[model samples]
Target chain A: MTVTATAGQPAWTHSLFRSGWLDGSALNFFLEELNPAWSLVRPAVRIRQIIEETHDTRSFVFKPAWGFGRAIAGQHVGIGVDINGRRHERRYSISSAPARGLVTITVKREPNGKVSNHLHDRIKVGDRVFVSPPQGDFVLPSPAPQKLLLIAAGSGITPLMAQLRSLLSGRYSGSIVLLNYVRSQQDRIFGAALDELAERHPQLSVHWCLEKENAERFSASQLQQRVPDYAERFALLCGPAGFMQVVRQHWHEQTLDERLRFEYFGTPQPFKPDDKPAGVAAHIALARSGRSIVAEANQSALAALEAAGETPSYGCRMGICQSCRCRKVSGPVRNLLTGAVSHEPNEEIQLCISAAEDDLVLDY
Target chain B: MKKPHPSRALSPQEQDALAAELDALRDSVVADLGERDARYIRRIVRISRYSAVFGRIALMFGFVPLLWPLAVLALGVSKILENMEIGHNVMHGQYDWMNDPRLNSQTYEWDNVGTSDNWRKTHNFKHHTYTNILGLDDDLGYDITRITGAQRWNPGYLLQPAYNVVFALLFQWGVALQDMKLGRYVLGRRPLTEMFAKLRPIVRKSGFQLFKDYLFFPLLAGPNLLAVPIGNLIANGMRNVWTYSIIHCGHFPAGVRIYTRAECKNESRGHWYARQMNGSANIEGSRLLYILSGHLSHQIEHHLFPDIPAHRYPEMAPKVREICERYGQHYATGPFIRQFGSVIGKFFLYAVPNLQRRPRTA
Candidate 1:
């Protein structure tokens, strides 16, 4: 299903121009001006179609630019969109089967989400969006497991849908039990598609859990009763934090954690200093200015710096603009958005969304 | 060079009022930044790049009478726009909201001999934070000439008039070397090994620049080797002298105030804004000159809002001037000739030693 498309460039010319005197900038400029889908470096894609998946969610089908590569099913890619002249990048899980020519990403509108709202309302077919190569290890493994269980809630159904379609389309011949929870049928993404898929596929079973109806809430005992062989199935979980927390606890209690894989979206809850023992505070060093300030475990590096009366240049206090991105010469910092703890030395970090986890030196 | 009459200093409450008003103006402009500002910068980039490419091509045929001068002019325009309107403003994080990697302050490399990394420290952080404070801001005279009486007069400065011409002609070289702290190394304060280590990046950057302008492009011209290199020299020379004049006018002009390091310690936001206003001068010019100067023509407004888009400085200037006037503050601005002439006048004035040790502040 993957296509190996390459932008034509003479190897000798590329090597010759690779000298330090020239940058890809000039070529990138002309390429972007001629057609947004053309670029020397970034993988720019054009929106081929917009699919209305639900009342609140829409799926965009993208035709990759020249030299585009294939993405694995059940993986996420960072999509860059220009809204109000400012470029904002957000990671979206691919919601389509891994195939050549086109890729689809389902976006759910969030009230305060700038990029999401633009994707939902302003963006149209044919607009170009810059995309990062598909990433994340939440995809189905090679030698697909037999008797799989996929649990998704609300918009979380996107990635699971990809995996489900990929599995049904000759990747796996095993049975898959899909558990999808939504507020109502109106909010259920891919409701009709799931129904059609279930009707055509004999080994696939789809369950719809609507919170608006008097459907019983998911429980460990209920799951055991519903599927007697649940412990034997490799399970993929995606939902709100509370739902995932409940499932995680149940799996941990049963010592079946090895069989369960989960992914959550949206702004991650910051590390709670109150939950941790004392002495979790971080010391932040401004390398160029030769100043140091202590950041409480609860505060972001930017907040701590501002509180200490240092005016580091910043814009859009959120991580969207990357204006406050600085070099972290050394330290551990937890990204407030993705909840990823970075321990890499001399890495670039956004001060607005990163909370220092230890003594940190920044090239500020 | 006669000093202008000092304006009345404001109290803390008055200063706070001025800051709040100016801050609100800045907020309004920031809120309104959108497609127009983004388009403006991109257009400038396009024009700059096109000019550079076309100029080089034209210079390949520079043996023709009309093409030589026109090619050099175009190339000069390209370099000026790249360094000033584009590179300088973008390095201030002005277009960071656009989120384009090409315009990102920390990562952007300009068509200059100076490395952008060195500039982020020497210019963006130090020069800005300590605008006109003697012994703090390296830009006070770029550690070469004494612009302010606050700096101790040394015997080396007696040849400043001659050095000023050389510095202006090779202005970019001076800026590129500013962060190297060559003086300290020469004075035995800095180690030779450390200085050489720092020189590596500068050498690499300058090497590529020299190669592109002098050797590579000219060689690529095939038969027009001599003409192309001469065109590049003219272009680079034009940019150097022009930038030198514009920058000197904005900073070292007569009537511009200078401060001491002690005077700026623990400075309040209002006082800082006040200092930036006092320490900088502006040149009245046409729209073309404004763009050519990267809107550094509105140097007072630029110093106040270093992070704001330079294109917006023109709009912000009158409002800034009004605020200064209401606060009984001096807003220095004049025609380019007058301002630049005063800057030249200071070269001679400070070349001879300040015989009497006056108060530390100027």
Candidate 2:
């Protein structure tokens, strides 16, 4: 049946009617109230199961309520929760492949981490948690490379596991090697899964470098010994800052940086000095709020504003995301990321990364 | 210059101490902020949208006659709730920490014809800052009514009763025009270019609203187009009247005091708190009534904790009232009908110069 637009009726009229107008709109509203996962902003998911990987680390499997688009292997999603009346968000890599019909996020509880500790201690099966649709560019490249090397340490095995699972499932015709580093055998995540996959697939090789047990560190020689043609492989790395730094140096020295991909879970901690620049306090004037706050040389504008009980909109809390960008109406600011001092008036700066170097006015 | 009534005066040290105490109250509330507030607003938003859409659809069947009144009533309630409970508090930055762009105070635009940007400047900053001080708060008489005796009496006020009725009928339009400062334009205090720039959004919003009600939905009804437009008119009129009554009761009740610039000179935080309490009145009602009023029923609490989510006001009101009592201040509150009646009475009373003696201080 050919359907044509009726006279005096716009093209959208039929679609609007088919969409059920008020009933359709009401259905969406009702579903959203029932669970935010039905909405576009931040769809929610329920924790289906929790698997303990280590004393401090666990994997949470989730079943999203609705409209959770597929995430490519090695991507991450932002997880948010309300704890004691405050909403906190943190991004975690998906550990499960898209074909799994569920998503899993492996988390290692940090002593001072708010969202991580909350997920570890408070979250339980059947509890709903809000999550942004999967995002991040850390996914495996299109047209898979002929050779691949996956290196991970601590809780960083998550995204690599996803890639490994997907590659194995896709029957990837490539030489694949996984070098997993942990404190001990007990600390290794997905140990049995890796062993099973290696045993089943002749092209897949698995190596565990137990730092405490074997007293071994990741080096180019060690990597070469296991995967002789390591130089010809596309490498993926994830781990603690120290481990990642060492691996980065190794890749740089070998001129393999072009073939290497990595992702950081959080912003790198700035090196601290015994004493901050003495008497270098800069006054940050919030123009809209008509208030001035003192920002020490060690503090970012965001930290200073937060300390002064001012809430400025922010997300990611990292320079990579521009959510915290604000107009710097006046004065000097030092970009913590670029290590460049800017005195340009009326320039926009990310509050999360810019430190007040001189008296600054911000359109907060 | 007039001073604060001697009975209400406090030493500088006392004022600072009281201000610190009030600050502590605000700090405590801020610290206690959480998901419940977010959930409360989200629920209201969902309900408002559902009802509004349902009302519009019901009006499509306006030819049925019986459904028209129900549709208009539903639409009116939905619009009122959206403007008051959701839009007002959200735009106050109460839920800004949620980081949802739709609910951000700096970004949220209400369903009303009043532009959110203008409302933020006029209502959020100016009115909240000035409360009921005569010259500073243009809301004292909406620059038109003669509800406060402090406002200069003129022959123009003799027509106040007629104007008051007209104002009530078109309260939303008046609010839209309020920020435009039409009086300033007429008096040549504001430039024509600036006035038009300010009027641009107002005109655009009003045009869209008119099209949605008088044109789009009505035309969608086809043979019932006339009935749908009439239904829209009734709905808008109902919303205006209801909003006007609630708003007037909040500030114009008999016991609610209006302040002068001289009385509030160099006002400390504690003094500001006192003025807010004196300037605003609350309507006592059931939970349903409170919800219907968009929690404006707790206007005194709203004035004090303007940035806190309005849903939390009822729980906070008693504590705020206790603090006021401890400071020997009056927290005006009464039933809705009594408050509305008192406001109407005050409107008539202030129409002419007071035959009664003026306060000695003034």
Candidate 3:
């Protein structure tokens, strides 16, 4: 049931992708400790049983031969798997609790996910994987036993289950109001385990619902009415981008709720849009001798001013990223990032990103 | 089978082309900074250190009754330039081993020299990150600049080159202003450190003294001190172009080009090596070149290994060049005259200050 639910990757992951993360700056720090590229750390876990959660989601259970360290419910670790010729890595949260060492990873296959699909079809028990230490700030707040809420639409329940298992094991005895919804009752993952947990803990309650369930099962409306205690609990919602949007719109009346926590799947949101401007166009040239390409534009006076020829030295094309920066040879440039303007602007403008509105020349 | 966005977005052919160009350029930049240029920088660090000592002695004797009082003043100018560069290099952690706390503050102490803001920003951030990002780069053309460089002669210059002489001869008028202007740039661009924070109060006072002495002293030079004024005029013109030509020579090579964000993404670190090599050319390592290049003649080495002491760079540069060649990269370098010519080409054809770039053909 949770198979299809867990397969969906949130859109926020795109934000976390950065170039310097693989940089040599860390080279100095880690060079003596490990090889420049790969490091062998202590083993994280030993694969045990694989559980099929839903149509698209499957949980690979692993027993920690070495001790599995504690991790925050929403935290993640970068897992690198050797596939074909490349070592592919991605971050994932452990679904099981620390005490069990039975690490359960609920994976949902995407259209062309490299590592995800590989894990789905090829991975099995006894396979050793390289993983980084636990990394992330998302977790349940301490000083527990307070009224808490856990909201998940699909596979977002992986981390929430960790929290629940933690509570069940007495690491944290917080009162949780776990509200998980799926397409149908049969699609609901951990249905048997959730019912058992509810039976064991007096304070732990589960409000499971299905948007489209069997005729005999309660629907979304009935489930909404069933969870009458939501108004009082802290909301930690995790799901797909579109799911969150719908959930947010559904509770627009309470949009200003202060106790809201969310974990999106992809990159962290930047303060501003990555594609804010139409972007400066310039006709930047490259020297005939070198391979450096220039940025050139026609409409922007600044870009036009830089567009002297067809060639210039450029490494990266995404402007505002700093690969195509060049000096002001003759005219003025209004820096797009910081609004200041100046000349004798030795390296005032990044040509690849900035466009020229005037006739310009570059040494390339 | 579906592929990730990366494999599909940049076609295999395009990636190959980008990769090839990147390797070629990186090789050029590394070789540009090689093993044979040790003596040139030795002179600058030595001259700066010795001149500073000379300036201190002259300051002590400036009260002499008949000892040609101008001797102290003359030595001071030589002291400031050499001292500033020495201060510049040391802030990069050059003198840490000397063990003089004043010479090597626990916190890399260039700020106390009243020159660099924080060595990190200028040396580490701007020089290293973008090395020379055209827009965001603070290395070559920050809104703020030392009063004595070509950007001074280039577009939107606030001062003229003749001020270096005026700064030397009629220095009472020009020196303070120069110091003040240079200070602002450092303050704005410097990577603030503990030493900088500690010396902030004094730096603020020296900054104030700039105006009081330069602007107010003219009324006191008593009108007939025209020799100082004539000297000031010569210095101004000489300083601007001299500094301009020198600084521009560091990164403004005919082969050197800037990369955009998109361009950088396609590039791996190996590719960045290409950018630095083709992006900057090393001029001949000569006494004159040393004075002008600030030992930056080893452009590729400096870019590749920023933390190694600049003095050591001349010795270690060849190893770096070899690395580039082994990697199938370019190490762009040449004689001083060739470098100077490249600067001229860059200034006219490219430095329009406009960032409009042409479509990059892989």
Listed models, DockQ each:
0.34, 0.25, 0.02
Displacement of the residue A159 alpha carbon in candidate 1, Å? 0.7
Interface RMSD of 1: 7.3
Candidate 2 per-residue C-alpha lDDT over A174-206 given as tens digits, one digit per residue, 9 for 90 to 100: 989999999897888888888999999989999
The sequence of per-residue lDDT tens digits that candidate 2 reaches over residues B154-189 is: 988878877899898888899888967788889999
* The candidate that achieves the highest lDDT relative to the unseen native structure: 1
What's the true lDDT of residue A288 in model 3? 27
Interface RMSD for every prediction, one decimal?
7.3, 11.8, 18.2
Q: Would you estimate the TM-scores of all the predictions?
A: 0.86, 0.77, 0.38
Task: For model 2 chain B, give the 10-residue run with minimal summed lDDT.
Answer: B1-10
Model 1 lDDT per residue over B196-283, tens place: 9999889988999899899999999999989998899889989999999999987898778888777777777788889989999999
Q: Which tens-of-lDDT digit does each residue in A157-264 have in candidate 1?
A: 888999998889875789899988898869889999999999999899998888787465689777887667889899999877788889889989999999998886
| Candidate 2 clashes between residue pairs 3 or more apart in a chain or in different chains | A37-A44, A85-B34
For model 1, what is the alpha-carbon lDDT of residue B199?
95
Whole-model lDDT values for every prediction: 0.81, 0.76, 0.49
Better of 2 and 3 by TM-score: 2
Q: Please give, for residues B1-362, the per-residue lDDT of candidate 3 as tens digits.
A: 21211111344454455556544543444334332223333455455445434433443343455422343344334444443345445544343322222223112222122333333334444566665544445554334333212232355332422333333344322222322334544676654474466556445544543432233323334542333333333333343344445555677665555544556654555455556655566766675455445467787766654433455556666766665565545566778788877655443443343344443332
